[model samples]
Target: MTTISALTVPDERVLHRHELLALGYTPRRITAAVRDGSLVRVRRDRYVRPGTDRAVAAAVRIGGHLTCVSALAVLDPEIFVFAHDHVHVHADRQASRLRGPGVSHKHWRKSEAGDVRLSRRRLTEPPASRHLLAVGDIVGQLVRCLPEREVIATLDSLLHRRIVDEPFLREVFRALPARYRRIAERLDARAESGTESLLRLLLVELGIPFEVQVRIAGVGRVDFVIGGFLIIECDSKAHHEGWEKQRSDRRRDMKAAARGYCTLRILAEDMFHHPEAVREALLGLMAGHPRA
Candidate 1:
């Protein structure tokens, strides 16, 4: 009779410590398996089954989990892009020093809130108690957990607080989904990109028919276009660097302008910190050039 313990996927995570002991596999046995290339140690107490997805196998072997961006991607690759780094797992700080190569662990303190807690895929139980979450639940967990604005805020705060170095923050940011290209323009409003997101949102709210990220003829791409008549550009200082950038931007604007495209550039400060100004400017721009 094949028991649950006996059932093997070769790649499934080794769950509990007792499971390892139950197999009656001694260190000599493990060493022999390693020598034979049949077993690979993922962490100190973790061994991966050959031919399985390394991250999933690593997660299972460690009896922890793959969470954050990696989990998001595995759960919904379409929505959440994969981060090409260590599989992030919530683990004890002490156990990590003893972990094998390539397995990155993040310490979970009680101070952390809804952020890390959002992406936990419940450990699979026996068949009788299984209740899998829906696709919507997965997506919702990822989106609400991210909240682009919050990422920006965290970045800004990190600098302000001088708590950690930029390198660390960069790694953390790199582990996040860059942008939702599918709903980028519409959801921009939901993001902290302020001008870009808000302008897109307001235009949608105003029933403006516009194409996002449309490339212009003999000119660079515009942020969004209204009925092929007007071009909208959302400029945040975070994206623009210096005078050379200003000159390059002007050149692009000139090209669009020469093509009889009325261009409007909305700044980030104006869009978010002062939204009324954005509304007024957008309203004036729309009024002058009615969408045809």
Candidate 2:
């Protein structure tokens, strides 16, 4: 007579074995559900509702504890998920395997023990002060972690004070994909903006020649210039707010028009969420101006 919907989780995405026990599901029932494809095992003691998201399920099934970027994103859904290696429970000595793929363990001393949480069976993030970071945050942090010669020194000053631990920094470098390793080497942490970084990468992929942070005749300095006829501006909403930015952008557009250069404004949302649309728009715009 116990309906699964009768149960509730502290975090909708995370679930613990004891929570299921409290719900009257015995080990036999749990195993039966798995056999019947009615439940998915996340970790040794964890079972998530069948067909749950892979990341959530994995977090539950491999529940020694997770921290760093994966934990941060899982705990704070506002942050986007990008990195692959999930930081997991670690002791000074190697422990028995927790039960899942894609899990990375770090040997934490007792001082780092209480950092992991088991709320509803899902992994959670450590405090920001504890040197945890997300993918976006890591991109900025790497500028300082790598030697000055490895990346531009300008980036060091930008990220030197920013929080990223030595371990997570090493993980990112080791995990860097072959395709992105070269780009990683060229990253400058003090570059002033993620929008600028993403835009530059896109432009490079698009084969558009341009200058960054250069002043136009009337529009002052834009993010990029293409053929001196197009001005590209990258805006991050977190940095821009209210009617004031809108008005300033409008005036800048007018000035660019007066100087005979076309203006294209790219927002962070457009870049991350609607990349295809942005790409199509850029393609259409460039159709009129073939590459020379």
Top candidate by TM-score: 2
Candidate 1 accuracy as TM-score: 0.43
Name the weakest run of 10 consecutive residues (lDDT summed) in model 1: 1-10
- Each candidate's TM vs. the true structure? 0.43, 0.47
Deviation in Å, model 2, residue 164 alpha carbon: 8.5
State model 1's lDDT. 0.50
Clashes of each: 3, 4
Candidate 2: C-alpha RMSD after superposition = 13.3
Question: Model 2, which residues run further than 4 Å from truth?
Answer: 1-180, 290-292
Residue range 1-292, candidate 1, lDDT tens digits: 1112111112234433345668898767777876887876555555656774655554443434555444534443332132235464433233433222233363333243222232343322221101112222322233345555333332232233333334443333343356532232223222233345556556766677778778888997777888778887888786776999989888988888898888788886776667677778767777776555
* lDDT (tens digit, per residue) of candidate 2 on 1-292: 0101111111454456788888898988878887998776655565667666455544434433333344434444433333334333221123444443333343323344342322221112222221122333333333323332323322222233343333444444555445445534555443455456666666777887878778777568777778877888878777666899889988998999888778888887777567777778777888877542
Would you list the C-alpha lDDT of every candidate in the order shown?
0.50, 0.51
